[model samples]
Target: MAATVTPENPRTSPTISRSVTHTVNGSHKFVIQGYSLAKGMGVGKHIASDLFAVGGYHWAIYFYPDGKNPEDNSTYVSVFIALANDGSDVRALFELTLVDQSGHGKHKVHSHFDRSLESGPYTLKYKGSMWGYKRFFRRSLLESSDFLKNDCLKINCTVGVVVSAIENLQLHSINVTESDIGSHFGALLDNMEGSDVTFNVAGEKFPAHKLVLAARSPEFRSKFFDGLDVEQQEIIVTDLDTKVFKALLHFIYRDTLTEEVDEVSSTTSSDFLISETLTAKLLAAADKYGLERLRMMCESRLCKDICVNSVSIILTLADSCHATELKSVCLKFAAENLAAVMMSEGFESMKENCPRLQSEILMTIAGCEVDSCSAGEKSQSVWAQLSDGGDDAE
Candidate 1:
């Protein structure tokens, strides 16, 4: 039965919004062994590990094998995390781990989270403040543990940094127009009316701008503008075919491959989508011209299309071009599919032409077999089989 009340003004109670903040974590792993470990065994002898940049600050792991103090020597091992870069008081959470590699699954980990106290993460002030356990572990116990393998130990450190950032909220509607700079460049490439130089590739002419070519490639720059007599209006490229040259020029101008690559061949299976032959040729040309990004693109494409029929040829190309990542991928694939790959015609060609590649492949296969084989009798049996195969190949 009561009297009604009026609502407050909407303008007086306006909604307010602020930005969000988040944390980022970075981790680094360092392995110390051999003579380095012996040198770090003295009291007060601390070695600064290799510097790793994480969370905008340079950080390092400090190891004191015999402890940092005279009293703790022979009883405990000391380890610390140090900030190598200059900064104000920075707050971070850190974890130091000694990996266990002896069949057992026991790994020793120490971190700021281990403490049950209500206090927050450790705050490092200035550049040199250290945050770690002075008595990390007992020396005798660690020496006998799986953490120490072959007189070497692996230490992994992860740092979690808390940062404050603001992201503004849009309170008003806005309209934006997207720019099409790439399409404009594509148009410029297609309309090559004022081209200054021409490349004759396999009886076909490809007109290009001298400044544009020079801007994209150092090799082109050297060939055109580096010397007075070296400058030429027409250059002959006899090594590459017309199609490969066209694709290369397209990448130089448009930063992309031609659309024909998307079209599938009617003869081959759907799995064989891209032309491996064309990609291999392009990779060689890109390597020859020092186009690193283009070469990487070609390598990545070849890596994805690897199969039993293509592994041998891809391995040969990868080795010739010194494409490390692609070579590793090809080797692993060949090793896993060893019996089937060796039966292919491409494998025979690789064996006859590239003897060094054959040796590398055999060694890689041996390594793979050893990793999967258990220790003792089974490991020796696997090694014997690998040896027999190598002798037969020779």
Candidate 2:
């Protein structure tokens, strides 16, 4: 039997462990000629600076005219410094400075320096890893600020690669800092630094870190490692809408839907909110990406919005997205309120775009009528038999 420690007896041992870690620092200055012309080059598109050597590695800078995130909608300019050579598990710190063109000496700077962090230096898993900002500065603001002058802009990037080894040293039970990994990762995502992947959806581009995505979603892990090319930096996503793809990325990075952006509702014409349609699309994207929790979240929100005006549309989406719970709710709701649903604009759309859904709706109503045969079966049969026969709507 193992012995248990008592108040009178304590376990004690000599601690002599040491970690040898330090950073090799370097800086690169990049000048952009014709900064004015670089505007509107397209979202996710970049003006690349010449490669520079730093800390035994090669690095380069990228400037995005229309912002790096699709959801930002071209409202800001983006800048990021990236590792150019193939590497794995390279850890580092970075600082980016946007030079003030005027003599005011008020330059904009984003840095991970001279501050105590809950976590150590960030780790980059592979090449093409980047660090910077998706919205470094607002477009109109930057255009008018002292940073841009004479059609040129100057920027500086500093990299400090973290090195580590084992060494002999004294150790003690030191008090650790409070947990802040979420905020650290959140900072990484918002800072857009050390991102290694670019996902293009419908013309909008989003930059993200690969290991983060792979760790969060199994589907992403498979896409990155199992069969696909690991070094494929840019991925084109054609099926999902730009907004849908952005929300997916948000959930992948942070594990929650961000409340920063809002959309115009297609169904209600509401201003600045997460609309039902967007949620439904998000549910589909989440399912596709194998983000089950996010899918459930979207499905839950969509569940509360079901009504006669939206049931058919919701039902069709649920069917396609394979959201069994949401689909069951929608089908039952549609069958119980068949008259109101048929008169709805959503029902008409279902008839046109998804004839199988029309059949499914009819069949669901027929099933309900069968259970309630005493509630006039012949009359319900007339409506149930009205379903069109066609492609997979059922």
TM-score of each: 0.50, 0.45
lDDT of 2 at 220: 88
The TM-score measured for candidate 2 stands at 0.45
Candidate with top TM-score is 1
Q: Which residue pairs clash in candidate 2?
A: 130-194, 131-193, 131-194, 132-193, 356-393, 356-394, 357-393
Lowest lDDT sum, 10 consecutive residues, model 1, at 264-273
lDDT of 2 at 64: 89
Poorest 10 consecutive residues of model 2 by lDDT? Answer: 266-275
- Residues 224-322, candidate 2: write the lDDT tens digits: 989565999999988887877777877876677867333333356231122345776788888788888888887787777676687777777887888
Highest lDDT scorer:
2
Cα lDDT for residue 202, candidate 1:
77
Kindly report which residue stretches of model 1 are placed more than 4 angstroms away from their true locations once superposed: 1-168, 172-179, 227-230, 262-276, 366-384, 387-394
